[model samples]
Target chain A: MPYMDKRNAARLVNDYADMIMRIGLMYLKQTYDAEDICQEVFIKLMSAELTFEDREHEKAWIIRTTINTCKDRKKLAFYRYWSGEPKEELVSGDDFTGNDLLEEIKKLAKWQRVAIYLYYYEEYSTAEIAMLTGRTKSSVQKDLSRGRKFLKNILESEYGKDYGFEKGGADYAE
Target chain B: MQNREKIKKAFSGVHFSEMEKSLMTDRISEASLFAKERTGKNNMKMKRWQRVAMIVAGVLVLGGTVGAAAGTDMIRSWSNSFSDFKTAGKISQKASELGMNSFPDEIAGFEYSGGNTVHNTGEDEAGNSTGDWDELEAEYKNEDGKSIYISQSPVVEGKDDQQHTDEVVIDGTTVLYDCDEYLFLPPDMEGKTDQKLLDREASDDHFFISYGSDEPETKFFKNASFVIGDIRYLIFSYDEVSEDELISVVRELIQK
Candidate 1:
């Protein structure tokens, strides 16, 4: 029998819907597209007859599916035409509150943004992220490192807050 | 840690609405139906040699999307193991014999968009080998971005064992519901189901959804299969297109 009974799907939705949407928003930077990706992920889950070793495995599948869906949408011709220029109105509502730092993070490459979100926001270990994303552990760590370095430079230039140049900032960088 | 915490909090307030959840459920249900059409391929138990042969042939055919694996083919009629070259040839020849221009350029009021004319020989779900079956798909896009897709193909032989559930009588004609079993709204959502909105007048953006309080709720769009003579017809929509519209299209095709 399939694992995605009505009860199970609802539970999965309740648990991971927010996380999937957040990942989408971080990668796509648009609320409507993020929401669409969130729905597609759940729909993919319903049809994918995957046997997970544990709850952690299932959660990883959800995250990976969300990322893959976003990437596929980006491959489309229309997406290239429209998504090349960030639609400020599309990003401004509830998803983005015009936060300077968050906007800067959106400027990162998709892989870098995903690694940073998983490490800092979701608090997943680098090893866990490697398994989820099918990337080497070193690759995920490298993305995290590069992402932080980029964030540090941007924030220091804008706010004069030497994120790594300050006393406690170096510790946080590690 | 300070920067990390700030990054998390900066984007923490992103919210998904109740309406969004409902719509997601509805779309998921629709996707599940499309997935069910491939259930036959999923259930096939192929041997090692058959798997090897399928991979080689799939690479050569390179349709890319169809028949990549023994059971992953969504074309539905390619049920037989294509391990034999002669059998494959016979199937192709049979498919070549069917006339492709039988379907209308437009279905209902929607205009045809993308279509594929295919003649494929494969096996049925029961492991019975089939000959070349001609298939045509007509995708009609409405002004509202809702697509009305009609796929017409010759009925596969030995389909007598197929069972029908959720049979509904419309205009004295019985049509078999061809969607996922979980798609129908359970009892709890029935009250919330607006009968008026379920009709054809509703906008494409409107969807029928049942919120499951404890468990997951079931949501479905109108989907059904009907047979007119030797041809089998499948009609479905991703939006608020009504079952009546689909059945009417089927009726119109049968009349034609």
Candidate 2:
């Protein structure tokens, strides 16, 4: 029998498609690439036979696979060459547009964008972000800090010093 | 934090439409069917002549051998090998040169895109050219941009490892049908057993499967192989095309 039936696949898509697409966009910065990564992750999920201990374990697996797939896609020679051009022309079809903070986040380095997205948006700890991204805790901490500081500076310059940009409540240590 | 809320709000804009989600779900289900078909299959065997022919082709493509003993003349003669052609006239000329009867220009709705021919020479232990072989690979594309790849070579009698699930008689020739699953391992995981590879595929880090094959965008495929007279032909369709369509294409090739 097939590992994942249509009903099961539809359930997975309903549960994880949004998260996968968001993570893919944070790393890839393109809607089409994010869509491709989302589809690829679910396809891999269907073929996988590993049983998860809980819902968190399955979510972690999907997040990590999406990140790795995005990294692999960026490593391709075609993407490397394609990304070297002007950013304005490159992200013309990007979905995350018209938001000042999102534009600044998109301008950050790929690692910084990933760290920021996972830390703030997903509410993952620094250690958890490091685990998902295959980086050291200290490295992820640095990325988070640097990314946060960069976004804060942009916000402060745009909307005065009263705009609140503070440390998150998530535990950072392993 | 307000930053968290804003970040979530911004990222939330990036998501698939309902139609895309439904389409993707169907694709996943289809892929599952392919995987189920691949279960409980023995390793596909490579013929000795095919092995030698591939090694020669690999060496030639690499420009020269990197390591191994010197004074190895693996290739003695090659004619019009590794040449790409788009037209049927070119394919027929190459097939005739290889002493083959005929090759199809189009199959089903897919027109012949392009193909390459390879002529390989094998050497005996004494460094003398012993035998020569020829093989060709062709690609066809339909109006929907889907493709079918066909590979042809002379049939060599050897231990066949493919477990044919079904067979059909076309023009008195029995064609074997098999669903093949290829796990494209990372460079570090090469030469591992199939079970180990499957375990890795089932693991959380299963991104290695995407590293190979751009057309299908996946690792596994459904294929049909058959021997007609002295030549063996293998057809691969990367898209979710029907098995009957593939068989019909094979029938066209044999009849041609």
Candidate 3:
């Protein structure tokens, strides 16, 4: 018997499709590649013979797999050969193309972009982000701090000196 | 925080349409079904191979000449095995433990990044494992983000699988050059590729070719493989570096 039947697969897709898409976009910065990652992740979920302890466990598995798949896709020789040149426009979606904050986020390094997205958009803690990304907690904390500072400087400079971040956010050792 | 809300709102606007999601669901279902069938078939094939291997082993034991032939074949087959590593140090360590030549820290303008090792245990198509041999690889990257992959393995005994486009004699070693083509078919078009286009060979220079109505996209990469001493080395460039540059890189490795 198949591990995941069509109905179960459909349900999983429905539940996590948007989150997977957004994560893919943050890592890959391409709508087409992100869409491809979504399908690939679902296919993997359908074939894997894995049992989750709870909803959070399953969700964490999906998120980690999505990030790993994006990294693998980037490592592929053909992907590097063809899409090696950075595109002027990171994403094709009108929603992302016009967003000032996302534009600044895209300018950050790949790791920083992913860390910032998970910390802010997905509301994941730095420790959780580190576990999901297969990195040290301290490394994840550093990425979040540096990424946040970079975004703050750019946003404040462009918007206004009054454009400030909310005080008393997640505490970091640094 | 206001920043968190703004980030969430920005991302919420980006998502697949209902139609796209439905299409992806269908594709996943079909792929899983195909994979299940393939797994069943592979299991049956493995059982048959095991039975055949038992008979072969019995004959080899009775013949009394198995040791010499098996040892030679074991060394020859390690060129085909492959395993990935997270860092170049791991690859170098494996090579040192196996008494194989170590890869350089930097080649041409690319610095050492990460690589893999190839291992062969004299396993044939029927899946019998015996003896052991290993190969090493090192990946490099330049300032421009271009990649150069170099792998060294035991010299293969038979003809190569890829069709080589050119050959050059570098210091008594024959190096063969070829372009590797990979096709990316969108999920919606799974198993729908046109037979003719699918079989068509990729051109050397063309990076992207769009087939008007639901066809797979093609990407080509250039590489050079050659045998030096008892090791075969392959150099692959991800960018559009010229064939001469590839040969020059190989010449540099030979000098080292």
What is each candidate's DockQ, to 2 decimals? 0.18, 0.18, 0.20
What is the clash count of model 3? 0
Comparing 1 and 2 on DockQ, the stronger one = 1
Clashes per prediction?
5, 0, 0
As for candidate 1, its clashing pairs are B78-B123, B79-B122, B79-B123, B80-B122, B80-B123
List of clashing residue pairs for candidate 2: none
Candidate closer to the true structure by lDDT (higher is better), 1 or 2: 2
Q: Please give me the DockQ of candidate 2 compared with the native complex.
A: 0.18
> Highest TM-score: which candidate?
1
TM-score of chain A of 3: 0.82
Best by DockQ: 3
Weakest 10 consecutive residues, lDDT, candidate 1 chain B? Answer: B59-68
Docking class of 3: incorrect
TM-score for chain A, candidates 1 onward in order: 0.78, 0.81, 0.82
Q: What is the C-alpha lDDT profile of model 1 across B156-245, one tens digit per residue? A: 543222333346665555666533212234435645666664552132222323233344444333456666566666665545677667
iRMS per model, in Å, is: 7.4, 11.7, 11.1
Where does model 2 exceed 4 Å of error? A1-3, A80-98, A161-163, A166-174, B30-148, B151-225, B228-232, B236-256
- The estimated TM-scores of all candidates read 0.56, 0.51, 0.47
- Residue-wise lDDT of candidate 3 within A54-100, one digit each (tens)? 88898999999999888877776546323232233333355542366
